[model samples]
Target: MLVIGAGLAGTEAAWQVAQAGVRVRLVEMRPVRRSPAHHSGEFAELVCSNSFGALSSDRAAGLLQEELRRLGSLVIGTADQHAVPAGGALAVDRGRYSAALTAALEAHPLVTVERREQSELPGPNQITVLATGPLTADALAEQLRSFTGRDDCHFFDAASPIVEGESIDLGVAFRASRYDKGDADYINCPMDREQYLAFRTALLEAEQADLKDFEAESAHFFEGCLPIEELARRGEDTMRYGPLKPIGLWDPRWGDVNDREVRRANRAYAVVQLRQEDRDGRLWNLVGFQTNLKWGEQKRVLRLIPGLENAAFVRFGVMHRNTFLESPQLLDATLQFRQRSSLLAAGQITGTEGYAAAVAGGWLAGTNAARLARGLDPITLPPTTMVGALTHFVAEAPCGDGRGKGRFQPMPPNFGLLPDLPERIRDKRRRYGAYRDRALTDLATTLEQQGCAARTSSPHGQV
Candidate 1:
């Protein structure tokens, strides 16, 4: 088995294949080759924030983690063992996590880790997995484009700014979660009706980061994390409906809310939440606030939030050019390129977003590719699971329904994308719990039927 790009997905895929008693060659073009987002040669390098999202089983991300555990995901297991405290979220020490993963892969007897750029397709008979991720090197990316016959395959992704916590004006900013549900770790900037209106005006008129020459034609934003400036350009209330929803918050200093309705109206009309980015509590990232505005303009405009008037940014948000294939049209449910069953694609390159989802895809592709090599039928994950939903969405769904420029948008696992419950359930929490239960049960059955152990050390044992 040959796996390209020793990123999160590729690393997981190579591990899975090696554990399945296969001799695997894992290719990583690092140190000798590099991508825009990666800085080190380590395998499974996390370029973005360390947090992998909510860890509660009731949430979509949490449910996905549970499913991964059932299927024995190396990334999830490693993350738990090397976890950094972040309240309910599964955050990790990025440096240690990547180093641990690299060391483990190198130690695997059946795995040979190679450092080379795979610019073109290997032989037709070779069993290969391409988990190159979003920021693939240009030369190899072009080769992939040519192989896939895709003229335009790139997207633009932006990172949110991290601010020095002490530099924030606490007199104006408050620490609280929406509706006070979570811990008071999040720093919020409240805006009254007038302030929200004014801020909206400035945000819409703020100077944006101009598109680069290479990005002018192929730039598309991920739907899950759209740039804030793009949201403002759509409409004044777009942001209100999207990121600025104030349903779950109440300002305590604005007088007692239980006493009178008029007093509650004096509360914030809009709000922005900043999540902790580090263990020291020194930095906070602007949540749901990815942007491509010029650095100076970002500071000037974002400070309009009631609490951030004098905020000092530690790291400004920056955009990266990403490339991906239209999976629904080009790939099968197993992530095998439709025209070439021997070749499989995984991770962000396969149009699935998020670390957990990418790793799950890797597990699936690796298992199926191994099985095929061993003269076995291809396995498909149960559709009830988030991992299966991503596979089904990419493989079976029709790409175009008269929509302009018919394409498959890269998506993170969400409850909405999962199948509806057997019975009508109005409460979101209850419905999500049911979904999680169903997925786990289904995953358990699949693992048992395949005779695959959840976590294994012996190469000879099937279960």
Candidate 2:
């Protein structure tokens, strides 16, 4: 078995293959060649944040971490061993975490570490897991693009900032969707004329983060994912018509809409929507507020909105050059290419965002690759599990055919991706808890049916 890149996904893949009694060659191009984001040649280096997100099982990221732990994930297990204090989230000591992972993989007798670049894909007879992350080198990225028949395999990841749900002022922000078309899913923050204009002014004057040379060279923002400041700069009312549009929404707290006087007086000039970021509704992301603003500037400017006065930010907005595949068109749920089953893709390159998500992809790909090498069939986890939902989404989401038509985008783990429950549970906490319970039970059954061990080394293993 062969695995390319020594990042989170690649290292995890190598470890899994080796654990399955398969000899693996793990290749990494660092020190020899490094991306702009990396500071060292360490395996499983976290480029953005050290956090694996919230550790509660009721949360999507947490559920995925638990699933990986049960299935023997080297990355997550190592993270746990080197974990630092981060309250509800699983945060790690970066230097310690990466070093530990590197040592483990190198010590594995079945795993051989190669310090070099792998520019070409493996032959059909060779089962290989391509876990090269988002910042794949130019030569290998080009090779992947050509092989997959995709020229546009990259994009600028302008992610919006996520806020703690409990921090949002519910008195100011009401739950409602535009025109009441769907369920009252969004938390709407209505802004009057004066407030909207003031917020726009602050955005225009805010300081933007300086981009690295590589990012600056390719800083073109997609129209669909434009930064909030960019939209504000277009026109005073550009944002009003865009994400902050207040047309179809109405706040019940502003008195009965049946009363003409009350409706007219309470009409908002613009509104900011907060979409639920997790199943438990603990985190909410500012809808369409993707930006390149500096971290301090983001908090200062975004807080000018009515309900976010004391908002607690979970992850700030980030704008960077990210290379990912249009996986929906090329890969299966097993992470294998449709045209070539021997080749498998994992990590951010497969459009699974976040550290935990990358590890999950690697675990699945590596396990399946080992199975195939041993003359066993590759298995796909049930979609009810967080890991399964993420893999299935990347492999099965809709992607338009032909040139310049693919709409597949990178996605992080969220409850919205999972299949709905058999019966409705109204309480948010109970509903999320139920989802977590179902996922773990299903995962255990799958592992048992496959005759795989239910538990591996504990995550709290001595460092």
* Stretch of 10 with least lDDT, candidate 1: 454-463
Report the CA-based lDDT of candidate 1 relative to the real structure: 0.76
Off by over 4 Å in 1: 155-320, 401-403, 455-463
Best by lDDT: 2
Model 1 misses residue 325 by how many Å? 0.6
Query: On residues 1-463, what C-alpha lDDT tens digit does candidate 2 reach at each position?
Result: 8999998899999999999999999999997998888989999999978999988888888888889999989898889889998988899999999999999999999999999999988889989999888788888888887887765476566678878787799999999878767899889999999999999999999999998888876675555577899999999999999899998787878778667787678889999998775445666778788899999999999999999999877578877888888787788999999989999989999988899999999999999999999999999999999999889988877554623333455678877677778998878678888898898889999999999886743353310
Q: Which candidate is the best by TM-score?
A: 2
| Per-candidate TM-score against the hidden true structure | 0.68, 0.78
Clashing pairs in 1: 179-248
